[model samples]
Target: MNEQNDNAGLFGSGDEAPSNHSNNPHFNDLVAGITRRQILASSAALGSLAFLGATLPSLAEAGEQTVASQPLKRRNRLPFTAIPTSRADTISVPPGYKATPFIPWGTPITGRYPAFADDASNSAQDQAEQTGMHHDGMHFFPIDAQRGLGRQSDHGLLVLNHEYIDAPLLHPNGPTVVNGKRVNAEEVRKEINAHGVSVVEIRRNVRGEWDVVPSPRNRRITAATPMQIRGPARGHKLLQTRYSPDGKATRGTQNNCSNGYTPWGTYLTCEENWAGYFASADADMPRELSRYGLRSSSRFGWNTLPGDEFERFDATRKGASATADYRNEPNHFGWIVEIDPFNPESVPIKRTALGRFAHEGLIFAPAKAGRPLVCYSGDDSQNEYLYKYVSRDRYWPGFSHGRLLDEGTLYVARFNADGSGEWLALDITNPRFLKACLTARVTFADQGEVLINTRLAADVVGATKMDRPEWGAVHPDTGEVYFTLTNNTARTLADAANPRIANAYGHIIRWREQSRDHTGTRFNWDLFLLAGPQTDSRGPDGTALTADNTLASPDGLWFDPDGRLWIQTDMSGSQLSNGPFGNNHMLVADPRSGELKRFLVGPLGAEITGITATPDFRTLFVNIQHPGEGSTATNLLSSWPDGPGKRPRSSTVIITREDGRHIL
Candidate 1:
């Protein structure tokens, strides 16, 4: 979902400080225990056992197995053949699998909403009453069986994020641009309503087929929905505006990309790439705002609609102070929003302790009693930093999630060249960080300021800049963290870590914390997969990719309970049309051997994203976004998931095994 840009901007320019040797004896001791040698030896022995015809436990029984406190027991190899790359305008799953197109854009969730019109003429109010567009990251929260029984995966709430809008195809004739400005106010409103999260009640019928149930639980949290601002930045001066003078609340959450689910039953939709939607007219704008690429003109020109409500997109100083106008609207976004899927009346809360950046997603580490909850997030921008947040309070059997996220310490990663890394604290109380902020021309007035300008704080502390870090996933069995570095076209210089110059096809990196501790500040990392075209050079680790395994611009990542790593592609430009990477596909990889197998290929001009499986692992859901995005009305590349001649709509595809067996 990243748009390429030159690295000359404030957020992308500087090189991070070289990694320093660790002086902490405790950190050094933790790294020595599970050295590379020990892990490699364990992997080699496990591979030999598998080769000798050893049968591992079934994936369905993995939950009953007692996971080791240290490295987890290896699972069996993935049992599906690799689906070939194709340019077809339909989803192609494995031989024994079936995919059903369920709940596309504009599907009505309430009685007041009208059915989807084929002419693409749904009004703004119609969009608010119907399902939102562009389904991205999603989670299926299983409804508990009656009388306190376990999860009922057959029925639950399906909450998915509508990342952004396909404006041309959404409106009737197209977006109305008159004299370089948007003049159609109704068109802009429809676009706005289409850019948030949607919660729908879904149920599995007697035939085991799933569809929308259309119950009262169905709800849409659009761009106009009211939301409360919480955590460290709740009442910060930078977040104050005419909309909320106390800075404790705001209007809505938009541009939600990837997502996370809490143990206590809540959905966490992350805001990403929100900077391009704002405008600031003043010449002397805030340095932090400029750093994030907020300019005088937005990509959509929503502020040109000639009203104070529409002008809220203008984030510059006006009328003398912040409260006099909507000068701080941009600051209120770029956060992880928590929504209670079970309670339709509950208001969404913006958890500000997670820091403000283009948050790709948050993947929680395995929670343990007496230990602070830990989660990993990535800033999905070029040359951005990886972040980890440690809750201030230790987790108990029934701890409150809001309290856990409200107070925590956010840390930015500093990867050393010697295979080690340190988590630099973003807390202003640290004297070393305080001195670094002064040198970077940023003043840490308070902890709220530290979080508002998160990129600046990371820069001052010398955090390692990464290639566009996207979706992250935590191993269901092991505590290892894996994230996709989706691609960085602006990188001209090479290093041992980011070895490719102009790296179009990216890589995945995995790391383990000290002593399997989620809240520990030290870690050991290594490149998991270095992806590229077939003719491209092999990775430094001597891993070669062939046509069957070639993939470009890996974006969405997830780990099913069966310990399978699901990788989704987002190939762009000439690469999509020229290489082995045909229309974006989903691939499954073994974390131990890096053995990859293509699982499915999506429709033409669509990116395969939003991977989630039912608790039973029998039904899997995948989203097809922006189909026919590169085509014109007269020359459509695809009208798939519907039929020919019908306008292509972004929708969710439910996949399962035809024989009632578990999907591999």
Candidate 2:
């Protein structure tokens, strides 16, 4: 998903396109390959991307990123260009800051065990005992400063999400396959443990140091961890699996993408692009079949492995109906999970109040003491829909919220062709839903059912479909929410959300709430960014359509502490080696002026993701995920931070302004 934009983070996969993969093709609609006579004149003008390997590497290697390794003009200095963009192997930060590999795959998060044993064959239980990777979106909770812990104390909690797995290099001999099949149940158990979230307590010393503080509160949630399923789907026949016969609960959270934190103190981890892993065989799992958009087994063929653990993707209960067969297991996943990070003793819960899709991230509006709480999300797929949820109860300050989260209405966004939009509530209370379900004989006993089956309900209401929506961040100064609309491969002009014929570059669209009311139905919106070549695909459209303004596939997005919006890229296709842009890089934008420029570019074969700023606005943390991602550990395509000879590793970089100045 990082390679494209549908799923913004490096962990997940995207949903299927409606008709085609992408809406726009590079040139004019004309497909002319004429004879020698016709070849005399030019047919179409084409644009180029600056992502080619040979040219990019040669240019980057010639320059140096060792700017941080030497002395500086300022005493408490910051490295201006300490890290250069390269296809090398390592993460980079400012000269004054250091990036330690705090956590990696299979590392223990509880701080109870020694470092992970190299080549260790850990089990599902052991996995539940360790920290998971690739660590995607994270937030630092100040336990001492704000949570009433202690004033002026530099210590707090770290809440993070483990998005998904990096399968190839996970095992010693590559997942122990027996005759083209997965090796053992033990391997499957190890993988299950790697898929959830981690919450740990960290503290800083008077010397300004940061380290983990081992406490009983430190905990982990793995594949087999016990989670409470709270939604309409709970106890539904479709969710009944061999593991949970009653279907009231399930195992773990998979493909967790971007995350959000409620003002009331709960973690929202989204499940995105989850359907790709399942294999719904026609004859074996008719209950799991969905001819409209249902897919076959995963491309990785993990189900073919030689054990039952590898067979969960089969999606059949071996019984008669949905209840009999446990065929609806896939439904249990693909929903947003809410975890009480501070309450380590309590189990994490999945809030079905939010409609399901390829959930990229969940961002909430600033809570007013008596106002209805609201949140927004994007379905990370080509030509998907933007969504919002309104809490049924006003947010209660302090630590008073317990069951109110379960009672809410979910809605999908509909952007009008005239630039206005509406949030259609998908609740049983609506006349349309009540009448439709009654006529169709689909019984809905309570609000829980409505929240659980949110997608179907939204479809009945009709919401405006949008380009692939990714990670989103709200502008603290303006209260406007900005979300990344990664390119829709099947982008077409027939839809209002996508007006242009060839939406090659994609865009970042934002909207401001009317009077800052989260429950208000109407709001004003605008096109904050238009991505592509900033030139043209060669048509009647103005060259203004595709020029320096044009940049393909906007992905990771976040608002820095100072309110500056940082935009990152995920260029795939012909753009990489043959494109015009130098390489995938992170850019900074003045949201007030729309004046944007490249702040830092990344090396080849890497996606810049998960950016956050320190509370004081003096420091920034950015993730360099999956460097040389396409390369095997043996082949070694990219050298990256250290260059070719060293091993490629994923790490976080701390960016600070040079001269110790405030970053604008």
What pairs collide in candidate 1? none
Best by lDDT: 1
Output the number of the TM-score-best candidate. 1
lDDT of 1: 0.78
Measured with C-alpha atoms, the lDDT of residue 586 in candidate 1 is: 91
lDDT of 1 at 319: 75
Candidate 1 off by > 4 Å: 3-76, 145-150, 537-542
lDDT of 1 by residue, 232-291 (tens): 999999998988989999987888889997766788999988877787888987756866
lDDT string, candidate 2, 1-664, tens digits? 4554343222234444342222222111211222212211111121111111111221123232256643222221111332333333444443544444455555566744445544444555666767775666766666743332233235666666676665544554446655545556666667666777777676655755556677776788765567777755667655667667777777678777778877756667888766665656665433223421345545345566544455666664456665544366667666778777777888778776676567888887767777777788887765566788887777667743535556677777766533456777777788866776675566666666555455555555555556778989887755678888877655443232344565766677777665566677776565566666545321111123222234567888887755667787777646666656546667666543334555665556666766655566655556666566655446555665555554344445556555544554
Per-residue lDDT value at 128 in model 2: 73
